[model samples]
Target: MQSSSSYPEAVEQLIAGFRRLPGVGARTAERLALAVLRWTPEELHDFGLLLATLPERVGECRVCGNLAEDDLCPVCRDPARDQSIICVVENADQVPVIERSGGHRGLYHVLGGRIVPLDGIGPEDLRIGELRARLDSGEVRELVLATGSDIEGEATATYLARELRRPGLAITRIATGIPVGADLAFADSATLATALNSRRPVG
Candidate 1:
Protein backbone atom coordinates (compact mmCIF):
# COMPACT_ATOMS: atom_id res chain seq x y z
CA MET A 1 0.00 0.00 0.00
CA GLN A 2 1.11 3.53 -0.74
CA SER A 3 2.18 5.67 2.20
CA SER A 4 0.07 8.74 3.05
CA SER A 5 3.14 10.98 3.01
CA SER A 6 4.78 12.80 0.09
CA TYR A 7 8.34 12.20 1.43
CA PRO A 8 11.09 10.33 -0.39
CA GLU A 9 10.99 6.54 -0.24
CA ALA A 10 13.87 6.32 2.25
CA VAL A 11 12.16 8.61 4.83
CA GLU A 12 8.83 6.83 4.34
CA GLN A 13 10.53 3.48 4.85
CA LEU A 14 12.11 4.73 8.05
CA ILE A 15 8.74 5.97 9.31
CA ALA A 16 7.15 2.65 8.43
CA GLY A 17 9.82 0.83 10.43
CA PHE A 18 9.22 3.06 13.44
CA ARG A 19 5.46 2.55 13.15
CA ARG A 20 5.99 -1.16 13.61
CA LEU A 21 7.17 -0.48 17.20
CA PRO A 22 4.78 -1.44 20.00
CA GLY A 23 3.11 1.90 20.73
CA VAL A 24 4.11 4.04 17.84
CA GLY A 25 1.37 5.41 15.59
CA ALA A 26 1.55 6.82 12.06
CA ARG A 27 2.04 10.42 13.22
CA THR A 28 4.44 9.42 15.99
CA ALA A 29 6.41 7.33 13.57
CA GLU A 30 6.66 10.22 11.12
CA ARG A 31 7.83 12.51 13.92
CA LEU A 32 10.42 9.93 15.00
CA ALA A 33 11.72 9.67 11.47
CA LEU A 34 12.03 13.44 11.29
CA ALA A 35 13.83 13.50 14.63
CA VAL A 36 16.30 10.94 13.34
CA LEU A 37 17.09 13.23 10.40
CA ARG A 38 18.41 15.83 12.85
CA TRP A 39 20.86 13.43 14.43
CA THR A 40 24.57 13.80 13.72
CA PRO A 41 26.22 11.36 11.34
CA GLU A 42 28.00 9.67 14.25
CA GLU A 43 24.74 9.37 16.20
CA LEU A 44 22.94 7.87 13.17
CA HIS A 45 25.77 5.39 12.63
CA ASP A 46 25.72 4.37 16.30
CA PHE A 47 21.95 3.90 16.27
CA GLY A 48 22.11 1.81 13.11
CA LEU A 49 24.90 -0.33 14.56
CA LEU A 50 22.95 -0.94 17.77
CA LEU A 51 19.78 -1.91 15.87
CA ALA A 52 21.73 -4.20 13.54
CA THR A 53 23.47 -5.96 16.42
CA LEU A 54 20.44 -6.28 18.72
CA PRO A 55 19.58 -9.85 17.72
CA GLU A 56 23.12 -11.09 18.38
CA ARG A 57 23.44 -9.02 21.57
CA VAL A 58 20.33 -10.51 23.17
CA GLY A 59 19.20 -14.11 23.43
CA GLU A 60 16.86 -16.23 25.57
CA CYS A 61 18.31 -17.71 28.75
CA ARG A 62 18.42 -21.46 28.25
CA VAL A 63 17.66 -22.09 31.91
CA CYS A 64 14.85 -19.58 32.55
CA GLY A 65 13.72 -18.07 29.20
CA ASN A 66 14.75 -14.59 30.31
CA LEU A 67 16.70 -12.29 28.03
CA ALA A 68 20.42 -13.02 28.45
CA GLU A 69 23.75 -12.50 26.79
CA ASP A 70 24.80 -16.02 27.67
CA ASP A 71 23.05 -19.36 28.01
CA LEU A 72 21.99 -18.69 31.63
CA CYS A 73 20.44 -15.58 33.16
CA PRO A 74 22.17 -13.84 36.04
CA VAL A 75 19.71 -15.31 38.54
CA CYS A 76 20.37 -18.85 37.32
CA ARG A 77 24.11 -18.31 37.33
CA ASP A 78 24.13 -17.02 40.92
CA PRO A 79 24.79 -19.74 43.50
CA ALA A 80 23.26 -17.63 46.27
CA ARG A 81 19.73 -17.98 44.86
CA ASP A 82 17.14 -20.35 46.39
CA GLN A 83 16.76 -23.03 43.77
CA SER A 84 14.00 -24.73 45.75
CA ILE A 85 11.47 -21.96 44.89
CA ILE A 86 10.70 -21.00 41.31
CA CYS A 87 8.68 -17.85 40.54
CA VAL A 88 6.92 -18.16 37.22
CA VAL A 89 6.06 -15.02 35.24
CA GLU A 90 4.37 -14.43 31.90
CA ASN A 91 7.29 -12.63 30.34
CA ALA A 92 10.95 -11.84 30.93
CA ASP A 93 10.11 -8.18 31.63
CA GLN A 94 8.18 -9.20 34.74
CA VAL A 95 11.34 -10.73 36.21
CA PRO A 96 12.98 -7.34 36.92
CA VAL A 97 9.83 -5.95 38.59
CA ILE A 98 9.69 -8.88 41.04
CA GLU A 99 13.44 -8.73 41.60
CA ARG A 100 13.21 -5.04 42.48
CA SER A 101 10.53 -5.90 45.06
CA GLY A 102 13.21 -7.61 47.19
CA GLY A 103 10.64 -10.19 48.27
CA HIS A 104 11.94 -13.22 46.37
CA ARG A 105 15.44 -14.63 46.39
CA GLY A 106 14.61 -17.68 44.29
CA LEU A 107 15.05 -18.49 40.62
CA TYR A 108 12.58 -17.38 37.91
CA HIS A 109 10.89 -19.08 34.96
CA VAL A 110 9.73 -16.83 32.11
CA LEU A 111 6.79 -18.38 30.30
CA GLY A 112 7.35 -16.05 27.30
CA GLY A 113 3.57 -15.53 27.34
CA ARG A 114 0.36 -16.75 28.93
CA ILE A 115 -2.13 -19.24 27.54
CA VAL A 116 -4.74 -17.43 25.44
CA PRO A 117 -7.00 -19.81 23.60
CA LEU A 118 -8.50 -16.93 21.62
CA ASP A 119 -5.06 -16.14 20.28
CA GLY A 120 -4.30 -19.79 19.65
CA ILE A 121 -1.57 -19.66 22.31
CA GLY A 122 -1.48 -22.77 24.46
CA PRO A 123 0.91 -24.22 27.03
CA GLU A 124 2.96 -25.64 24.19
CA ASP A 125 3.30 -22.20 22.59
CA LEU A 126 5.02 -20.81 25.67
CA ARG A 127 8.16 -22.00 27.50
CA ILE A 128 6.05 -24.33 29.66
CA GLY A 129 7.88 -27.44 28.53
CA GLU A 130 11.09 -25.84 29.64
CA LEU A 131 9.54 -24.93 32.99
CA ARG A 132 8.35 -28.53 33.47
CA ALA A 133 11.83 -29.78 32.63
CA ARG A 134 13.27 -27.47 35.25
CA LEU A 135 10.84 -28.79 37.85
CA ASP A 136 11.56 -32.43 36.98
CA SER A 137 15.01 -32.01 38.54
CA GLY A 138 13.25 -32.22 41.98
CA GLU A 139 15.12 -29.14 43.13
CA VAL A 140 12.07 -26.89 42.97
CA ARG A 141 9.79 -27.28 45.98
CA GLU A 142 7.50 -24.30 45.33
CA LEU A 143 6.04 -23.04 42.03
CA VAL A 144 4.77 -19.49 42.38
CA LEU A 145 2.48 -18.35 39.59
CA ALA A 146 3.05 -14.61 39.04
CA THR A 147 0.91 -14.18 35.96
CA GLY A 148 -1.22 -11.05 35.50
CA SER A 149 -4.71 -10.69 36.97
CA ASP A 150 -6.45 -10.61 33.60
CA ILE A 151 -8.78 -13.41 32.49
CA GLU A 152 -6.18 -15.06 30.34
CA GLY A 153 -3.62 -14.76 33.11
CA GLU A 154 -5.96 -16.25 35.69
CA ALA A 155 -6.84 -19.11 33.37
CA THR A 156 -3.20 -19.77 32.62
CA ALA A 157 -2.28 -19.82 36.31
CA THR A 158 -5.18 -22.11 37.14
CA TYR A 159 -4.20 -24.51 34.41
CA LEU A 160 -0.62 -24.70 35.56
CA ALA A 161 -1.54 -25.07 39.22
CA ARG A 162 -3.74 -28.04 38.39
CA GLU A 163 -1.35 -29.68 35.94
CA LEU A 164 1.86 -29.44 37.98
CA ARG A 165 0.67 -31.09 41.18
CA ARG A 166 3.13 -33.64 42.48
CA PRO A 167 4.41 -34.92 45.80
CA GLY A 168 6.65 -32.36 47.56
CA LEU A 169 5.70 -29.66 45.02
CA ALA A 170 3.92 -26.71 46.60
CA ILE A 171 2.28 -24.62 43.87
CA THR A 172 1.09 -21.13 44.79
CA ARG A 173 -0.38 -18.08 43.11
CA ILE A 174 0.65 -14.52 43.86
CA ALA A 175 -1.93 -12.56 45.85
CA THR A 176 -4.66 -10.75 43.89
CA GLY A 177 -4.31 -7.50 45.80
CA ILE A 178 -3.24 -5.75 42.65
CA PRO A 179 -6.11 -4.32 40.59
CA VAL A 180 -7.93 -6.86 38.45
CA GLY A 181 -6.50 -7.22 34.93
CA ALA A 182 -3.28 -5.48 35.90
CA ASP A 183 -0.05 -6.45 34.22
CA LEU A 184 2.57 -7.65 36.66
CA ALA A 185 5.38 -6.25 34.54
CA PHE A 186 4.27 -2.66 35.27
CA ALA A 187 3.26 -3.19 38.92
CA ASP A 188 5.04 -1.14 41.61
CA SER A 189 7.82 -2.78 43.56
CA ALA A 190 6.04 -2.51 46.89
CA THR A 191 2.87 -4.05 45.50
CA LEU A 192 4.81 -6.85 43.90
CA ALA A 193 6.65 -7.45 47.19
CA THR A 194 3.37 -7.70 49.04
CA ALA A 195 1.93 -10.04 46.45
CA LEU A 196 4.93 -12.31 46.66
CA ASN A 197 4.94 -12.22 50.46
CA SER A 198 1.23 -13.03 50.63
CA ARG A 199 1.24 -15.76 48.02
CA ARG A 200 -0.97 -18.73 49.05
CA PRO A 201 -0.78 -22.35 48.04
CA VAL A 202 -3.11 -23.62 45.33
CA GLY A 203 -5.81 -25.97 46.71
Candidate 2:
Protein backbone atom coordinates (compact mmCIF):
# COMPACT_ATOMS: atom_id res chain seq x y z
CA MET A 1 0.00 0.00 0.00
CA GLN A 2 1.12 3.58 -0.71
CA SER A 3 2.04 5.65 2.35
CA SER A 4 -0.51 8.34 3.34
CA SER A 5 1.44 9.82 6.28
CA SER A 6 2.45 13.42 5.76
CA TYR A 7 4.94 13.59 8.61
CA PRO A 8 8.59 12.56 8.37
CA GLU A 9 9.43 8.82 8.52
CA ALA A 10 11.03 9.25 11.99
CA VAL A 11 7.81 10.86 13.35
CA GLU A 12 5.70 8.08 11.86
CA GLN A 13 7.95 5.45 13.46
CA LEU A 14 7.65 7.16 16.85
CA ILE A 15 3.85 7.33 16.49
CA ALA A 16 3.73 3.66 15.58
CA GLY A 17 5.74 2.82 18.74
CA PHE A 18 3.30 4.82 20.88
CA ARG A 19 0.36 3.04 19.23
CA ARG A 20 1.70 -0.25 20.63
CA LEU A 21 0.80 0.91 24.15
CA PRO A 22 -2.57 -0.18 25.49
CA GLY A 23 -5.46 2.28 24.88
CA VAL A 24 -3.24 4.59 22.81
CA GLY A 25 -5.25 4.98 19.60
CA ALA A 26 -3.90 6.43 16.35
CA ARG A 27 -4.69 10.08 17.20
CA THR A 28 -3.61 9.67 20.80
CA ALA A 29 -0.41 7.98 19.74
CA GLU A 30 0.32 10.79 17.33
CA ARG A 31 -0.36 13.31 20.08
CA LEU A 32 1.96 11.47 22.45
CA ALA A 33 4.74 11.35 19.86
CA LEU A 34 4.34 15.10 19.26
CA ALA A 35 4.42 15.70 23.01
CA VAL A 36 7.66 13.74 23.22
CA LEU A 37 9.05 15.96 20.50
CA ARG A 38 8.40 18.96 22.79
CA TRP A 39 10.58 17.44 25.53
CA THR A 40 14.29 18.27 25.94
CA PRO A 41 16.77 15.81 24.42
CA GLU A 42 18.01 14.91 27.92
CA GLU A 43 14.45 14.18 29.11
CA LEU A 44 13.77 11.96 26.07
CA HIS A 45 17.05 10.13 26.63
CA ASP A 46 16.12 9.48 30.28
CA PHE A 47 12.69 8.22 29.26
CA GLY A 48 14.22 5.88 26.69
CA LEU A 49 16.69 4.58 29.27
CA LEU A 50 13.89 3.90 31.75
CA LEU A 51 11.93 1.89 29.18
CA ALA A 52 15.01 0.00 28.03
CA THR A 53 16.04 -0.99 31.57
CA LEU A 54 12.55 -1.82 32.84
CA PRO A 55 13.00 -5.58 32.49
CA GLU A 56 16.28 -5.55 34.39
CA ARG A 57 14.86 -3.26 37.09
CA VAL A 58 11.68 -5.26 37.71
CA GLY A 59 10.90 -8.97 37.73
CA GLU A 60 8.05 -11.20 38.75
CA CYS A 61 7.78 -11.92 42.47
CA ARG A 62 9.05 -15.42 43.19
CA VAL A 63 6.32 -16.01 45.76
CA CYS A 64 3.14 -14.40 44.34
CA GLY A 65 4.23 -13.80 40.78
CA ASN A 66 3.58 -10.04 41.12
CA LEU A 67 6.04 -7.45 39.79
CA ALA A 68 9.02 -7.00 42.07
CA GLU A 69 12.45 -5.44 42.19
CA ASP A 70 13.78 -8.50 43.98
CA ASP A 71 12.96 -12.21 43.95
CA LEU A 72 10.27 -11.73 46.60
CA CYS A 73 7.72 -8.92 46.45
CA PRO A 74 7.38 -6.43 49.30
CA VAL A 75 4.17 -8.06 50.45
CA CYS A 76 5.71 -11.53 50.59
CA ARG A 77 8.70 -10.16 52.48
CA ASP A 78 6.52 -8.32 54.99
CA PRO A 79 6.36 -10.17 58.31
CA ALA A 80 3.23 -8.32 59.40
CA ARG A 81 1.15 -9.49 56.44
CA ASP A 82 -1.30 -12.26 57.27
CA GLN A 83 0.10 -15.28 55.49
CA SER A 84 -2.94 -17.30 56.54
CA ILE A 85 -5.21 -15.60 54.02
CA ILE A 86 -4.35 -15.70 50.34
CA CYS A 87 -6.39 -13.41 48.10
CA VAL A 88 -6.25 -14.86 44.61
CA VAL A 89 -6.20 -12.43 41.70
CA GLU A 90 -5.97 -12.90 37.93
CA ASN A 91 -2.84 -10.85 37.33
CA ALA A 92 -0.13 -8.78 39.05
CA ASP A 93 -1.87 -5.51 38.06
CA GLN A 94 -4.82 -6.26 40.36
CA VAL A 95 -2.46 -6.49 43.36
CA PRO A 96 -1.92 -2.73 43.61
CA VAL A 97 -5.64 -2.05 43.13
CA ILE A 98 -6.48 -4.29 46.09
CA GLU A 99 -3.59 -2.89 48.11
CA ARG A 100 -4.76 0.67 47.52
CA SER A 101 -8.14 -0.29 48.99
CA GLY A 102 -6.39 -0.86 52.36
CA GLY A 103 -8.90 -3.62 53.14
CA HIS A 104 -6.65 -6.63 52.75
CA ARG A 105 -3.45 -7.32 54.70
CA GLY A 106 -3.20 -10.90 53.57
CA LEU A 107 -0.85 -12.44 51.08
CA TYR A 108 -1.59 -12.61 47.35
CA HIS A 109 -1.54 -15.27 44.64
CA VAL A 110 -1.35 -14.18 41.01
CA LEU A 111 -2.92 -16.62 38.56
CA GLY A 112 -1.21 -14.92 35.56
CA GLY A 113 -4.60 -14.99 33.75
CA ARG A 114 -8.09 -16.37 34.06
CA ILE A 115 -9.49 -19.47 32.42
CA VAL A 116 -11.00 -18.55 29.05
CA PRO A 117 -11.45 -21.62 26.89
CA LEU A 118 -12.55 -19.56 23.91
CA ASP A 119 -9.15 -17.87 24.03
CA GLY A 120 -7.37 -21.19 24.47
CA ILE A 121 -6.86 -20.47 28.16
CA GLY A 122 -7.53 -23.16 30.74
CA PRO A 123 -6.68 -24.10 34.33
CA GLU A 124 -3.54 -25.78 33.08
CA ASP A 125 -2.45 -22.56 31.45
CA LEU A 126 -2.51 -20.73 34.82
CA ARG A 127 -0.17 -21.02 37.80
CA ILE A 128 -2.52 -23.43 39.55
CA GLY A 129 0.26 -25.80 40.60
CA GLU A 130 2.18 -23.06 42.34
CA LEU A 131 -1.00 -22.04 44.17
CA ARG A 132 -1.58 -25.65 45.17
CA ALA A 133 1.97 -25.78 46.49
CA ARG A 134 1.28 -22.68 48.58
CA LEU A 135 -1.77 -24.39 50.05
CA ASP A 136 0.18 -27.56 50.69
CA SER A 137 2.34 -25.70 53.22
CA GLY A 138 -0.81 -25.42 55.41
CA GLU A 139 -0.07 -21.78 56.15
CA VAL A 140 -3.06 -20.46 54.26
CA ARG A 141 -6.36 -20.68 56.15
CA GLU A 142 -8.53 -18.86 53.62
CA LEU A 143 -8.53 -18.54 49.85
CA VAL A 144 -10.32 -15.41 48.66
CA LEU A 145 -11.26 -15.41 45.01
CA ALA A 146 -10.77 -11.78 44.05
CA THR A 147 -10.80 -12.34 40.31
CA GLY A 148 -12.82 -10.08 38.00
CA SER A 149 -16.62 -10.22 37.68
CA ASP A 150 -16.34 -11.26 34.04
CA ILE A 151 -17.31 -14.69 32.71
CA GLU A 152 -13.74 -15.98 32.42
CA GLY A 153 -12.86 -14.67 35.88
CA GLU A 154 -15.95 -16.27 37.42
CA ALA A 155 -15.20 -19.56 35.70
CA THR A 156 -11.59 -19.48 36.93
CA ALA A 157 -12.76 -18.79 40.49
CA THR A 158 -15.29 -21.65 40.39
CA TYR A 159 -12.75 -24.13 39.11
CA LEU A 160 -10.19 -23.03 41.72
CA ALA A 161 -12.67 -23.17 44.59
CA ARG A 162 -13.55 -26.75 43.72
CA GLU A 163 -9.97 -27.84 43.19
CA LEU A 164 -8.66 -26.20 46.35
CA ARG A 165 -11.56 -27.05 48.68
CA ARG A 166 -10.53 -29.04 51.73
CA PRO A 167 -11.30 -29.39 55.42
CA GLY A 168 -10.33 -26.28 57.42
CA LEU A 169 -9.82 -24.31 54.22
CA ALA A 170 -12.29 -21.45 53.97
CA ILE A 171 -12.81 -20.65 50.30
CA THR A 172 -14.65 -17.40 49.49
CA ARG A 173 -15.49 -15.00 46.69
CA ILE A 174 -15.36 -11.21 46.75
CA ALA A 175 -18.71 -9.37 46.82
CA THR A 176 -20.40 -8.10 43.64
CA GLY A 177 -19.74 -4.42 44.28
CA ILE A 178 -17.86 -4.37 40.96
CA PRO A 179 -20.16 -4.36 37.93
CA VAL A 180 -20.52 -7.50 35.87
CA GLY A 181 -17.82 -7.97 33.17
CA ALA A 182 -15.61 -5.44 34.96
CA ASP A 183 -11.96 -6.20 35.75
CA LEU A 184 -10.59 -5.91 39.27
CA ALA A 185 -7.72 -3.87 37.84
CA PHE A 186 -10.19 -1.08 36.95
CA ALA A 187 -12.15 -1.09 40.24
CA ASP A 188 -11.94 1.97 42.48
CA SER A 189 -10.34 1.68 45.92
CA ALA A 190 -13.53 2.22 47.91
CA THR A 191 -15.53 -0.25 45.80
CA LEU A 192 -12.75 -2.82 46.03
CA ALA A 193 -12.61 -2.45 49.80
CA THR A 194 -16.35 -2.99 50.09
CA ALA A 195 -16.12 -6.08 47.93
CA LEU A 196 -13.21 -7.47 49.94
CA ASN A 197 -14.93 -6.80 53.27
CA SER A 198 -18.16 -8.44 52.12
CA ARG A 199 -16.66 -11.54 50.55
CA ARG A 200 -18.70 -14.70 51.22
CA PRO A 201 -17.98 -18.40 51.37
CA VAL A 202 -17.77 -20.01 47.94
CA GLY A 203 -17.98 -23.65 48.91
Each prediction's RMSD to truth:
3.0, 2.5
lDDT value, candidate 1, whole model: 0.88
Steric clash pairs (candidate 2): none
Q: Please, what are the lDDT tens digits per residue for candidate 2 over residues 84-178?
A: 99999888988998999998999999999888898898899899999999999998999999887878778888999999999889999999877
Runs of candidate 1 with Cα error greater than 4 angstroms are 1-9, 23-31, 179-182
Off by over 4 Å in 2: 1-4, 180-182
TM-score of each: 0.82, 0.88
**lDDT, candidates in the order shown:** 0.88, 0.89
Candidate that would win on lDDT: 2
Clashing residue pairs for model 1: none
